[model samples]
Target: MKSRRPKIVVIGGGTGLPVILSNLRDQDVDITAVVTVADDGGSSGIIRHYVNVVPPGDIRNVMVALAEIPGIYKDLFQYRFETTDDFFAGHAIGNLIIAALSEMKGGIFDAVQELSQLMRVNGHIYPAANEPLELHAQFADGTTLRGEAEITAAHKLIKRVWVETSNHHAQPRAAQPVIDAIMDADQIVLGPGSLFTSILPNLMISSVGKAVRESPAEVVYICNIMTQKGETENFTDADHVRVLNEHLGANFIDTVLVNTGKVPDKYIDYQRWDEMSQPVKHDFQGLRSQGCRVISTDFLQLRDNGAFHNGQEVVHELLNLIGQPRFQKDSRG
Candidate 1:
């Protein structure tokens, strides 16, 4: 009998998720991305306003990352209209396609699956919820705000976050396939994105959170290289993990990948990457206190005057973890 490949489920949204997913596609693992549905910004926010479907920017990017199609088609799908293009200005071709497909298919979840197969995606892309979700946050200063954009722009420390429908009443839930993916995974990776907005929104869902907390997989967190101005300003690596643990009400993270690389002072262009504040401080004892195995190394890549994770290096470490005794035993059964 042939041996089954490792099942790795990555949960998060924003630009960071795709960086990791794109690299993981080259590996010999069954990948599933559980994307957050709480985005209310950019072309996605615009589409969400006019359409009743979940935002497609993150889903669209994830699809392209795992897609096995030709470069020209991918480029065509990602093409965005110029500002002078009238009503189509600033809209990515893929975002519009996802919205149109969602309308035809009756849901974003099914639309993504259909598009995934059509695009020849190597793995699964599951939205955290079927419907569009709004992210709500309570700041450390005791103020409240709704919408991911508003929360991030508030520049205040977030106390808690949760998701709700457009009506702002009903609870959000993940589909069974998402839950099954989480429950049966050999490894579950989180972040390289905003701690509160991108990652926590998916976990805020009741069923998704419950499944993650109960899953036997080794939950790894790809901690961001730098702190974000409005989100994680002056945050240490441990602070990031603490926020995640607090929101879930458990120290569920099994391992954390920390970047020890130093970015040159002259390299970062604050004007272009205004959201980035400073390098994340290291707190080895603090991370160990939270019951997380810390893998601190130089996982940095500087490009376009911004700092990002070297996806190739991160994916290599992720694949290495799959061979551990615990993950090996779980995969066999």
Candidate 2:
């Protein structure tokens, strides 16, 4: 008889989440990705304006990452129309499908579930919220930016960030499944994405934040290899965990994955990897101060002139975290 697969719930958005999920699929684990809905740029932003649904770009990418199909069909789902088609230009076929399903199902949560089946996704994919969410950032100088694109484009030092409805009044919400996934998971992972915009937006949701704080699951944060332009200009690995703890109002992260690999002085091309400034500085002592067990490894890969965590190596570390005292959750579903 087969045993149950260890369940892992990854909470974040952006390109990073998919890399980790794609790698984790090789392991005997159940995966659930909680993607950020704070996107308001490019195809996602334009679609959100038209349909009033959570931007599908991040969710779509995650779906493709976890999809268990041939490369040709995956390419079809990701295909974008040429600029010659004025209206559909730059929109991914997968993005359009997600929007249509959202409208048909009356919410992004249901749309993703139905789409996940068709995609033959190995695990669940859920948007962080039910409705559209806007990202708001307060920079070091105390000025504020309204949207994800605007904040990243500003190239300013971000002091803090949070997410709420576009109107800025009522609190944002996470679907019941999102919270349940977190609370019942054997381990919860965060990161390898934007600190403020990508990871924090999902945590900033009221119930999601509270559940993360209260969940018995071991929370492992995979720190980024390079610093983002505006989000994490000169941050250390420990600084990343500090910001997440501050935003969530608790030191909940149990383990942090730090890349010990060094990038050559001029290794990164400024134009190709424009958003990143430099390698993320590491402060092992600082991480110790925060009660986090730092797992440093040569988990770095330079791709397309950008520094990224070695996805396969990162997933190995995550699997190791399971069954350990620190990562062991006391409760069962």
Candidate 3:
């Protein structure tokens, strides 16, 4: 089965990357999760600052998602330290482990590979860059900002965003494995996460973007169900595609999976979903105008009072996209 399974490269970060990968785990497909390493918030930020490594938050989550380990181990890995513990306050067990391993290996990429084996990860989990990456965004108003945390808090319309080394170096490089995975994949998936900080940061890496643009794989964009407040405010699905195409300088996306289900007018809890405000406005015509074959479906599920993509449904569609028709053998002899 492993020899015959279609190889897929799922690219993106934030909470959304895990959802699709967790669902795709049991399928007859080989998965390689290329996660973003640009996060500068919460436990990840603290650990990165002290340890001098890329923030491990997103990579840690991707690891848990792809891991086929014991239930207790998963729980223990996700457990957060209490605020009373001043030294370890708010740090997740896995985040700390990733930080330690990065220090042990002297880089993030090798550290992730080591953990993947220890965790029994069903597929590869690679950080977008082996070093800390600082995200810089230029607003549509000509103003510029740095850091993923800063950009999220800016609440301004962004024109374009790119990645730079945390030490302020202009060049950002993705690992060779990352580039090789995209170039060798049968399908390359983008998104189901923050459009600017999550998905775009990885693509902003010069080499990774080039590989995706040049790869013959079927590129798919999984459009988010809701619009983020400061990030994608009142943005349409086409707006998402437009930014991606502009960044890569080509209409590389071959297909887009869009959620057509109606989110009840008063469905979202403003208190909880403070980041994302409303359902992403659909512009099917515009999506088609971009030369993308759009597959519309009800890929919505409400959990923890927040709206999320129906992982199973999305994974089913992915399997279908790569599934070749089987021919029955004639047994007349």
Best by TM-score: 1
Best by lDDT: 1
By TM-score, how accurate is candidate 3?
0.95
Clashing pairs in 2: none
lDDT for each candidate structure: 0.92, 0.89, 0.89
Instruction: Give the winner by lDDT: 1 or 2.
Output: 1
Quote each prediction's TM-score.
0.97, 0.95, 0.95
lDDT for 140 in candidate 2 is: 85
Which should have the higher lDDT, number 1 or number 3? Answer: 1
For model 3, the superposed segments whose C-alpha errors exceed 4 Å read: 1-3, 324-333
Q: Flag the better candidate by TM-score, 1 or 2.
A: 1
Best-first order by TM-score: 1, 2, 3
**Model 2 TM-score relative to the real fold:** 0.95
Can you write out model 3's per-residue Cα lDDT over 206-253, one digit (the tens) per residue?
Answer: 999989987868888999999997899989999999889998887777
